[model samples]
Target: MKYFKYTQYLYLVASILFLISVIVKIINQEEYGLQAIIAVGFAIMFFVRRRFVKKMENNKKNL
Candidate 1:
């Protein structure tokens, strides 16, 4: 349960990074492909973190 807090922070950071990548791609015509790839990676990490955090919380309750 305590460590779940860290996962929550990770989710926030991942979301921020994803948004930043999107913004970077939108503002700059060049390197759009790189930015898109980064954004996709961040998005995947964000969702994974979200699911892991939920699982952790559930496990704590089961304890």
Candidate 2:
């Protein structure tokens, strides 16, 4: 159901958000737990999206 072409844009947003989160955490130096959780969550999503995109591309090639 997911359109693979949009994954690149999704990653772009996620990466920017992740960078912002890291910067905020570094600047504030507080609540390390929440910041770490968010960072990890985004990282996992990025990998999942990457895999889904790759699968979609392979399927497209076959068809």
Candidate 3:
């Protein structure tokens, strides 16, 4: 449960990595549409998980 708080950041990190990969692929004149899509997905997941973690923490506090 304690780990859930930090795990959300991993998604952010993965998103960043995917974005970087997209940039690199662009520089090399390669297709990066899929990576770009996945990066956005991960970014969304990061935010969603962050909110969920905050909700969990608040619920714990209320308990």
- Give the Cα lDDT of each candidate: 0.70, 0.72, 0.97
Local accuracy of candidate 2 as per-residue lDDT tens digits, 1-63: 566667656765776687687788788885556656666677777788787788878998999
* Candidate 1 lDDT over residue span 1-63, tens digit each: 577567656656765776786787678755566656765776677677778878878888999
The candidate maximizing lDDT is 3
Q: TM-score per candidate, in order?
A: 0.62, 0.60, 0.94
Please provide, for model 3 over 1-63, each residue's C-alpha lDDT reduced to its tens digit, 9 standing for 90 to 100. Answer: 889989999999999999999999999999999999999999999999999999998999999
Task: Identify the candidate with maximal TM-score.
Answer: 3
Model 3: how far is 48 from its true place, Å?
A: 0.3
Q: Rank the candidates by lDDT, best first.
A: 3, 2, 1
RMSD of each: 2.6, 2.7, 0.7
Extract clashing residue pairs from model 1: none
Clashes of 2: 0
